[model samples]
Target: MTAAATTHQHTNCLRCGRKLTSTKSTATGYGPTCTRKVKAAAKAEIVATYKPHLVAKAEELIEQGGIVALRGRNVFQVVASNGVDTYKAARQGCTCAAGLKGKHVCYHRIAAHILSLAA
Candidate 1:
């Protein structure tokens, strides 16, 4: 019997399947061009996929500075409609009802994600 650690080698780009020659590319998995395209597509997806009204609401939330990133924490405080309650939104999940139930994508999570990308 033996205990050993195994290391996996990445020989191709995760994005385009191109052979990885550079150490930086191998470490990151995604090539330089794909990385840029991925970042651009993320912002575009935020605008294109979500409902127009929801996007507007999310933008308005950002404008009000309601989405605050907690220092040293990976969570953001999304201001509630009542202005009293707080919804803690993580990178892709939120504490709001909609987020919990997964019925619809709440504006709180969207606001948090938008702010995260901006930072």
Candidate 2:
């Protein structure tokens, strides 16, 4: 067989490196089980380390027109709730009362984090 034909003949699962068995697997280049595992791992990695409350707050901030601004290095300011409240968001923590005590992740910090990810 020609070199191009030989190369095209072998199809391997991208995740497990196993020979592709089914037509669907060959088309996707990943076995169904491996694809599921990969998706699960990705979801777990994103959710496991983050605080769910903070993520929810961040989403809320986005929906409410929260504005995030950089005051200085490692310092951010989040104006939320239609410009009613302004909170300082820093790398160490946030300036909000809840963040001051280190009891939980505050919405300001979460909003700043979300803005950073978007940028």
Candidate 3:
């Protein structure tokens, strides 16, 4: 077999580390069940962290011509009426005043979510 074909032979799911037998599972490095679990977990996390008011505010900001830029895989830079704000939606969270205070969700994070969904 060719080198590329040999390298593509994955034997286990990357997330669950379970043995893979199906053609699709080997090719993707994740079994169908594992993929569903991962996707569900991600969706649940987003739902858990979501704040309705913040999301609304973010939508308003976008409607007002705010710009959102991807700084990294999970980080985003949002330029709005207030100013430039950075938000890491994956782990670090938003660096805005509300986020830093640990009291409420920030509009920047919601904006980042909107941008991510659009992408």
Q: Pick by TM-score: which candidate is best?
A: 1
lDDT digits (tens) for residues 1-119 of candidate 1: 11211122457654455787876665555467755654554467677778878877876665444555674335777777666678898757889888999888998877666655544
Looking at candidate 3, what is the lDDT of residue 111?
57
TM-score of 3: 0.44
Predicted candidate 2 versus true structure: per-residue lDDT over 1-119, tens digit per residue? 23432233327654345798887666555567765663454344434656877666665553333433455324565664445567778646887788889987776766555444333
Collision pairs in model 2: none
TM-score of each: 0.59, 0.48, 0.44
Comparing candidate 2 with candidate 3, which one achieves the higher lDDT?
2
Q: Which ten residues in a row have the lowest lDDT in candidate 3?
A: 64-73
> Which is the better candidate, 1 or 2, if ranked by TM-score?
1
- Where model 2 places Cα greater than 4 Å from the true spot, the runs are 1-46, 72-74, 80-83
The residue ranges of model 3 lying beyond 4 angstroms of the native Cα positions read 1-49, 80-92
Residues 1-90 of candidate 3 have per-residue lDDT tens digits of 244533565686554457999987776556777656544543544556776666567655543334334554356555544343434442
Q: lDDT score of model 3?
A: 0.55
Candidate 2 CA-lDDT value: 0.56
- The lDDT of model 1 is 0.64
Worst 10 residues of 1 by lDDT: 1-10
